[model samples]
Target: MKKAVAVILLAFALTGCGEPKIDGSSEQAFQTSMQKVRDSLAEDKRAAFNDAIQVIAFSQVSMKELMQAGSGDEGGRALIDKKIKGALAGKTGEEVIDYAHKIKQERAANQ
Candidate 1:
């Protein structure tokens, strides 16, 4: 009985330790979301939106940090969040994705 219980516990632990799924569904969803946001943005805001995306792409700050800062709603974090929100306003997901693609192509060409 002891050996059976040990094996069952080990099996459960091993199952939890398996590698996470790497399917691109999450990436696709992200692109879709970006496109939607970009599409909603005003034409005048598109430049700011692109600049904001570039900042995110090039900055050392992690997305989690940015999200946390935005949510904090105090001090410099609030200011940062406001600026980012302003830039992103009225943008669509498609434009975001396209901008990312453009950045990728530019990087590739430079390399």
Candidate 2:
């Protein structure tokens, strides 16, 4: 009886000494939380980038139209830059498309 009890206690002690079981559910939960954080950050970055692109696109299209219309005149280039720079100054690359359309409209009207 004493040997049996000692063996049982030893087994329990050995089990307790080993690493805890963080099973599949806990790991899954951790992974899910991490992924959510990453996804949220990615979305925010994408939005900022889109905004920058919108600004740049507006400037590019505007400059292109103005330059084409003016036949490469320096005055036209300056005018285009003056009109579009303010709008595009703080934008990210992905957000420049919006401004490009606006610039296109302005250039068309000026021509």
Candidate 3:
């Protein structure tokens, strides 16, 4: 699972770093989005992630699977990160379950 996440984050980071000037707003958005994900998990969903380390909380599935399930486009990292933001802002519980379910389903599909 961690391997899958590393691959996804690698692909995500590589795709974004293609240019010399990185967009500052997007980076800020990612930071905010990541924080929201951590906070939401810590506050309402204990099963999702650890709030202290600011990393993925769920150990059962890879983030790639969750993004695939949530966005269904294999979207870019920023886009997927935004989706998670949306989950945290609007539909916290449902989105988390959706992410988890989709992660498992996607992972199984690949295996």
Candidate 4:
């Protein structure tokens, strides 16, 4: 019974672990990640986890813009999604947003 239970639990956990969430918007994505972290982790870790998720979601916006720029190209959009999801891995939301802002500043200065 224990072995069966453990196998089932492991399989279920693995399913969610490998996939990255692609949210429609940064805010929505962060909210979803925060909720998941809040539900699964201790209270003390929720804030940090939430911050990390926020960064991913924020950075994810760049992907959306890129996809939109290549609008109607399904292949291009799919590629953008994959790249953004991978980039969001193990990052803080604040860190992502701050980096984005810095890039924007550099672009503006160059202009």
Candidate 5:
């Protein structure tokens, strides 16, 4: 689940700037759209979403680099975008965040 979130985050970060060849939305619009998605999520999910955003915000990764990685690589980027969207389809934000938290708790217990 962590891996899934990481992938989604990476993909989202990569695709956020709106690849000219792959995405039609502008960067501002893409951010707005993502915010809307987060807003639509339930409270718990919103918290998790906020946490994820914070992580991304604090990370040293350069969004410009991420965007460059996605550009000129339509196939990989498009596939990841599609898969992440499909995997998240119909899932409530709360459920996704709860699952992630559950996994974290179990991992901590095991350790």
Candidate 6:
């Protein structure tokens, strides 16, 4: 009985350790990358780039809304969803959100 209990406890602990959490540090990295993209656009004064930025921002905001919903913040989630559906004109909501994060990482790395 003691051996079985010990084995089960060990298994439980190991399983928990396998999943990784995105904490404050990772979130900061994401934000820093986004800022760099914005700064680059401002410096260049490219009209097309500015338009793309607007779309990307819409996507990113929608993603945040989805995350808020998952976190049990229903009001925030609904607002995000409504904004995404109503304001975003070109890209699919999912693609826009995913691309924005990808761009954020690329911007951070290039800087």
Task: Estimate candidate 6's RMSD in Å.
Answer: 14.1
Q: Highest TM-score: give the candidate number.
A: 5
Candidate 3 ranges beyond 4 A from true positions: 1-25, 42-47, 50-97
The whole-model lDDT of each prediction reads 0.55, 0.51, 0.49, 0.57, 0.52, 0.53
lDDT of 3 by residue, 1-111 (tens): 999999999999898553122122465754565455555453555454333122223443367766665775655544555544444443343354555566567768999
Best lDDT among the predictions, by candidate number? 4
Q: Write the per-residue lDDT of candidate 5 for residues 1-111, one digit (tens) a residue.
A: 999999999998987554121121444554555566677766666667666444423232355544754686666555444444433343344544554556567758999
| Residue 4 lDDT (model 3) | 100
C-alpha RMSD of each candidate structure in angstroms: 16.8, 20.7, 19.1, 8.8, 16.0, 14.1
Tens-digit per-residue lDDT, 1-75, candidate 2: 999999999999897664222122343543453334334345656454445445553555554666664796777
Candidate 6 CA-lDDT value: 0.53
Model 4, position 12: C-alpha lDDT score:
94
Order of candidate numbers by TM-score, starting with the best: 5, 4, 1, 3, 2, 6
Clashing pairs in 6: none
How much does candidate 2 score in TM-score? 0.28
List the candidate 6 regions with Cα displacement exceeding 4 Å.
1-25, 46-50, 57-111
Model 1 local distance difference test score? 0.55
Error of 2 at 6 (Å): 66
- As for TM-score, the candidate ahead, 3 or 4, is 4
TM-score of each: 0.33, 0.28, 0.31, 0.37, 0.38, 0.26
Error of 5 at 65 (Å): 14
Give the alpha carbon lDDT tens digit for every residue of 31-109 in model 4.
5763543555556755665565554445455766666747787776666656665665444444444455565577689
Q: Using lDDT as the measure, name the better of candidate 2 and candidate 5.
A: 5
> Model 5 TM-score?
0.38
